[model samples]
Target chain A: MLKKRIIPCLDIKNGRTVKGVNFIDIRDAGDPIELAKKYMQEGADELVFLDITATIEKRKTLAELVEKIAKEINIPFTVGGGINSIEDVSLIIKAGADKVSINSSAVKRPELISEIASQFGSQCVVVAIDTKFENNDWFVYVNGGKVPTLLKTIDWAIKAETLGAGEILLTSMNNDGTKNGFALDITRKICQAVNIPVIASGGAGKKEHFKDVFTQTIASGALAASIFHFGEIPIPELKNYLKTQNIPVR
Target chain B: MIAIIKYNAGNTKSVENAIRRIGFNSIVTDDISTIVAAKKVIFPGVGEASSAMSYLKKYQLDEVIRSLKQPVLGICLGQQLMCKHSEEGNTDCLGIFNTKVRLFPPKEIVPQMGWNNLQGMKGDLFKGICDEDNVYFVHSYYAELSEETSAACDYILPFSAAMQKNNFYATQFHPEKSASVGEKILKNFLEL
Candidate 1:
């Protein structure tokens, strides 16, 4: 049995956390290392640092920041955003990142996943899918929800697993900042299609939403940003609630 | 010098860095002579039991580890494999501790990964550590708490958080990732 993980994602740009209201009105949260340390102390099962910048110059800065945080924190962490090549994955893994998550590059170059999986094992590779429900059909959105891929959400997740992704991180753009709950149907459908663990990202308001998602959806973990950032729901309290609900948490 | 027995474990470098942070030089190795000659040995691993045990046998480390006269420390999978037997590979362990490694059960979480409470610590490893200190753990299998258990954590069942039997000591958590509480535990092992 694997426990349901509670993760706090920190979207980084210019060495600061950019928080948005509904993913807009960006505000400075703090340094990536400091915020990550705070979350780890607060019982974050894992941390995700999304380098919001994709430009050539920003890449090095993101790697430096990742190295700083990785050196500072002791828990497992994943680095995403602008991870386009196998070299990037290898560099981050060597820099002490427990896992490297690929999004747009994985969708564009499907072979990269298997190449990485074959070399570094699937357990170290994670495929993060940003999805937006457009015209009643779920379309895979890439480039941080700026570009849309041709694959459907469910189909893309199944393909990712076949491509040797150990974990699937599904983020619902439509429900991302809604603070309602997870896309339970989408989570369940994706979980049923793929045997790999699925991490449900986006759309969490209260602590009870975690319980609802874990029970209604087949999700293995829940990831949130604003809710955890603003201290709306601390992780330990959330885990305590889930524990009372008979949901396994760590 | 602190020597970390590394036969392809993921967390060895992290442990090395942690020791360095405390002003100590450590070596990560699988060499029996180097380990046997060291004043202290730390067995660190983050892999499945079958493959790890295979590495031990492939390198003939099982016999070397059993015959170690100096203090030996095991972490996470290292601790589980120090027990009598493991269901991970249906393999026989070094039996340094009178315990058995078993799956976490299907109904419960398989890999109990994250920070959890450690209680009832009673060795030099907990010298400056307190009860309920959160230590980072990641594994699908765990060692059952027997008389050798020094500390315990509760998930689906009360499992061994730390174990001590003579010079053989083990912990189901990564003290390297455990912040100040864990740093102290590692320091205690070094001083022991």
Candidate 2:
């Protein structure tokens, strides 16, 4: 059986983790590599490092950080944020990232998904969609959720799969940081609309929220940042809780 | 020394890193001599079947891999290419293992990704690894179960998780990315 994955996303800026990760025992809270190793130890099925770094010049720093994390961590990890071209994807993959996630660049050029998918197999290409329920319709947002697009969230997700994305990282802007729960309706709709796996991101506050997403929707994975970082919900305990709920997790 | 075959496939760097983590030195190369002379040869890949097979033939790595006497392990697409044929590109494979690769039915997810458990294990490669231990996998096509199948996994259908025949061993999952369970499998291969 394929287990539901528990992923902890690390937001990076200038090669250092951006979000305040409140791990008590962690020596350097900013060191992405250290935080990555800790997540792997805590039974995180996979990790996502979203490079929130601003300047294009410092892209090399993310690659270096990826290489460092790859050497130390054995599980799969994906690198995203600011990846706009084949060269950026190549640099990260060659640096040992298992996959690369693309957002605005892909929206700007839908062919970018096909390009990366062709160069490196589709399995290495992750299409991240930032969506918010607006005007009684789910709208796809770009530029880190600042710019709204005409594309509907479900339509964009289906389009991305057709363009050769192996996975969909669906983050609900409305549910993000709310701690209410996942946007189950949109998530289930997208999961039903696409053959590829859908990872439900944002709004993960407690263990039950994880349970609600997995049981309520066909989400293959659940991703949260502060909850895992601040020790609000330890991964091992969550996995155990899911197992009891009859949700297979790893 | 270990030689990880380098071609047009992805994940060679990760395999090399995994080897280094286990306290062994390996070189990522397509040189026939280096692969032939190494104590172990790892054919790790993540790519399409036909293009990968053509690249292997273009560099004559196919023949070199087919004739390797030392313990040789294939990962993911590496395992698929070792089979006799693949439905992916309707391409003929290395024929090291007498099996056929078929695409999973669209009744379920096309590319079954993430961690899945292995069963019916029987080989030196599975030493110390328990049955139903999960390993990471990401592939759309799978090799059919055969006499060479050392381990099996079920998702959509029962397929070869790991296969072995003489010096050639293959795994449909990425052992390098499978964390501790994978580390144990790689350690077993290195020890063998």
Q: Please tell me which predicted candidate would have the highest lDDT against the true structure.
A: 2
TM-score of chain A considered alone, across all candidate predictions: 0.93, 0.99
lDDT of 2 by residue, B3-88 (tens): 99999986798998998898999999888998999999999989999999999999998999999999999999999999999999
User: Which 10 residues in a row give candidate 1 chain A its minimum summed lDDT?
Assistant: A20-29
| Residue B2 Cα positional deviation in candidate 1, in Å, after optimal superposition | 1.6
Top-scoring candidate (DockQ): 2
* TM-score of candidate 1 on Cα atoms, chains taken together: 0.78
TM-scores for candidates 1 onward, in order: 0.78, 0.99
Which docking band does candidate 2 fall into? high
For candidate 1, lDDT tens digit of each residue in A26-132? 23246677678778877787899888775777776776776777667867788888888988887777666767899999999989899887666566678999998
lDDT of 2 by residue, A71-154 (tens): 999999999998999999999999999999999999999999999999999999999999999899999999999999999998
lDDT of 1 by residue, B1-192 (tens): 778897854646678777886778999887788999999999987766777788898899989998898999999888988999999879888788889999877644334545677778888888877654567776668889899999998867888989999999999988887767788888888888
Best-fitting candidate, measured by TM-score? 2
Each candidate's fnat, in order?
Answer: 0.14, 0.83
Alpha carbon lDDT at B158, candidate 2: 98
